[model samples]
Target: MIDWLNSTALTAFGVATTWAEVLGFGTGLLNVGLLVRQHILNWPLGILNVLLLMVVFGAAGLYADMGLQVVYVILGCYGWWAWLHGGADRASLAVRATTGAEWLALAAAGVLLTGGLWLFLDRLTGSTVPLADALTTALSLLATYGQTRKLLENWWLRIAADVIYIPLYGYKGLWLTAILYVAFLTLCVLGLRAWRRAVLA
Candidate 1:
């Protein structure tokens, strides 16, 4: 029974990780836009994808990415609760554009966090491309936080991160994951368009 379970899990993990990444990237594109548009249902779907990707990144030995997944789990929980009760009178959160000041702050924070993480991981873990990896990881965290708050700028951050991640994952031989990011890049464009319409409406 245990062996069967293991076999099942392994097979499911293999197929689901790659396929789910493809599907999940699409969902995530919509999810992030929905988030920025203050749609309540986005949180649940986002959480589901995050949980799945945690296992996938772990198996791939992308430790920074694996750690980022753990962060996503927490962000998912926070996003869920926030979307439900974050607005006035405990209503759903509202869609909001980012202020210029907020954009500056986010950029500064991303740079500092990424730089620090790169230094730590490079020294302790001997990570290849630690700077690039940490930059993506840090920006992603910022984006997730922005998403939970229904901030419009999260899509921009996602677009920037996906640009870097395409080659990074491909270089690492995570071809499927790289492709997923490519798809994610396309989705980001669609998401931007969708959210713009939502905000204008």
Candidate 2:
């Protein structure tokens, strides 16, 4: 199983990648499905997705994104706990919109983190597409946090990241991952709609 998961198998758009990516892509889609339904199981599936993709991104030299998986693990744990108990009397968190101040804070964090990581990846790491890598990483962090907090806007952030990721990963030769983003983009739209209705409920 380990060998098979770690094995490189497919070639598309002139780039050869691994079975791990294929598995990661499949699980990622599952993760999105669960999130769209507001199911807490998304956290565990997302954790698994991140672990697999970490290897794939590391192999592709997207060091920032490779590191993002670690963040996802931490966020996944937090989201799982929060979804269970981050509410009055240990109730589940409800979907909601972010306030203006909250939006400012999130936007600031994304911008600053993107700039810092871009510089570090450009100057220190062997990363080739530092700008796009850092942007996606930053946006992903915010989006994951938004999901943890049950914010309706998380899906928008993810959708934005997905648009950039499609071409970015494609250019980096992660064809399967790019395709996964396409699927994610579609799911993000649906998640946004579902979560919006959830907010109304």
Candidate 3:
């Protein structure tokens, strides 16, 4: 029993960095809705998550994702301030869905960004998973922006990305990260339901 416990601890230590990232990602999704609803506590939690994700993605050689975390850090701060002060007479921010035109623009931008990154990284770096990396990176950017704007469709984008991310991370031997994405899939579902209810109610 002692030996089993030791093994478990060792394995956990090996994945400690990824575990932090998982916790952060989970909190981030929850924070997104909370922020959309103008809750004051979302920023700190989001900052914590983005900080951890920066470390994890950097270690994994996901440069774009690492950069995305940096953006998240900035956006998280901006969002915190905006939620608190950018409203009429400094009131809480309200939830607002993205328009169809904006969604199309975002989608087009995602495709262009993904394609551009794929081209550059495929030629400049010797990454084994360039295409998958590019796709996930681009989609994450879109989802993050959508989240910032309180778009109801962000959950759907996250859901689609996680479906691909799970297999990709698993293939790269990032089992813990893959598990996180799997959990993210579940959270996306919950987020969708929760937000839909909020929209209806």
Candidate 4:
């Protein structure tokens, strides 16, 4: 399965798109689409999506992104359980706005993690776009953590990360993954609107 996933799925626009990238693209779309609807299934599908993307990013030498996927898998697991039980009296989760303190903490953590990952990737790995990779990776973790908590601001963080990710994936020749991020950006917008309505209700 690993070998097959690493093999070429198709040649599009002269780029040999891997099976991992193609499947990752599909799962990523489904994951976010479900997320927009506040569905629990998004967690499992998101886990699958990141697992596939780990292979794709590994091949592309985006080591930071590759490592990010591993963390995403752990976050995905926590998100799955949280959505099912992390509410008042251990009920289902509900959408809510982030607290000001939470926002400040997330911002501080994002900066610190980005700087730390940037240095590690730049000095310890062969990552060519270490800063951008680290930035997006940090933003993605913040977004995913917010999502797990049913925070509306998660969509904003996702929008920020996807904007950087689209170009980064494209530069790495992962055309399908780049396109996936474009779709992700659109989903993030929809998610923001939907979650806002949920909070207002």
Candidate 5:
């Protein structure tokens, strides 16, 4: 099963695209599309996407990103529950802007997480892109957390991470994943606009 997943699905533009990356890409598209529509099914698809990409990133020696997938699984589950019952009196979550305090907290967390993960990856792992990996991982965590809570700023965080991830994945030779991030960046922008409209409505 693992072998099949890692096997090349296709070669395009001189890059061999793996089945895992293909499936992850499909699921990622669905996940973000659903999220943009405020649909509840995005979480399960996102979990599957992360699981597939965990294999892809691990193969690319992107240790921090591989580990980020593991964290994403946990956050995905929490997000699933949060979307269902994380609102006032356990209602479905509604989109909202982040509070000033939440912004401060997320900023502090991003800095600390990026620094710690960078140190660990740089000193303890064979990762070549430790700083970029750690930075994206930290931003992704904050974005996923904010997303779970239906915070509007999550899209901005994701946009930032996706921009960085494009070049990082390309440099790692994961061209398919890099392209997926490009699409994700677009989706994040759409998500941001849609959620802002939701907030206003």
Candidate 6:
């Protein structure tokens, strides 16, 4: 059990990794931990996780996700600033829920962005799973944007993305990342509950 769990996969590309995966996974866990706690540390840990996962995804031929990491860096910065100063008198941000209209708009945007990215990847890149890649990437962008706005529904979006991410990364031979997403999915649920109570409070 220990060996199977620890073993690295995908040696053909010379990208077989266990420790890097562990480090990245650990950092991601911490990032979400801080997020659940509504602490300020989530941003920096998120940056570190993005950097690490960029290498992981790049090696796995998920170029869209690699690019997504770059976007994550930018969003992380924005989220950091918003969390610090987006409230009254530069206070910490408060949690909020998305309106029905905003939800509809976000759904429309998610679909359009997915289609656009799928076309882009299919035509311009050597992506093996462009549709799945595009869909997850687009959803992740929306979720990240939701987090920056301090929306409680962001965790739902993340959970949605992870549903695809788990199988995608596993198929790509990033077993560790696949495992991490399982952890992430669980955390997303917990985060949703935590933020719900936070909003009520």
Candidate 5 or 2, higher TM-score: 5
User: In model 2, what are the clashing residue pairs, if there are any?
Assistant: none
lDDT of 1 by residue, 84-126 (tens): 8988899977767898998899989988999888887788874
Backbone clash pairs for candidate 1 read none
Query: Model 4, range 28-68, lDDT digits (tens) per residue?
Result: 99999999999999999999999999999989999988888
Q: Supply every candidate's count of residue pairs whose N, Cα or C atoms clash at under 3 angstroms.
A: 0, 0, 0, 0, 0, 0
> Per-residue lDDT of 1-201 in model 2, one digit per residue for the tens?
656766778776776768889889999999999999999899999999999998888778999999999999999999999999997799999999989999999989998999999999999998889999999999999999999999999999999999999999878878889999999999999999999998887
Please report the TM-score between candidate 4 and the true structure: 0.99
| CA lDDT, candidate 4, residue 171 | 85
Q: Rank the candidates by lDDT, best first.
A: 5, 4, 2, 6, 1, 3
Give the 10-residue window scoring lowest on summed lDDT in candidate 6: 1-10
Better structure of 1 and 2 per TM-score = 2
For candidate 4, which ten residues in a row score worst on lDDT? 167-176
Report how far off residue 7 is in candidate 4 (Å). Answer: 0.6
Query: Native-vs-model 1 lDDT?
Result: 0.73
Q: Per-prediction RMSD in angstroms?
A: 4.1, 1.3, 5.3, 0.7, 0.7, 4.9
TM-score of each: 0.80, 0.96, 0.80, 0.99, 0.99, 0.90
Q: List the residue pairs that clash in candidate 6.
A: none
lDDT of 6 by residue, 1-201 (tens): 334433564343345765446677889888988888888889989998998787767766889999999999999999999999998898878999999998999999998999999999999999999999999999999999999989999999999999999999888877767888998899899999999999998
List per-prediction Cα lDDT, in the order shown. Answer: 0.73, 0.92, 0.72, 0.94, 0.94, 0.88
Candidate 5 lDDT by residue in tens digits, 36-103:
99998999999999999999998889998899999999999999999999899999999999999999
What lDDT does candidate 2 reach at residue 10?
79
Q: Which pairs clash (backbone N, Cα, C closer than 3 Å) in model 4? A: none
Candidate 4: deviation at residue 123, Å? 0.5
For model 1, the superposed segments whose C-alpha errors exceed 4 Å read 1-39
Candidate 5 lDDT score relative to the true structure: 0.94
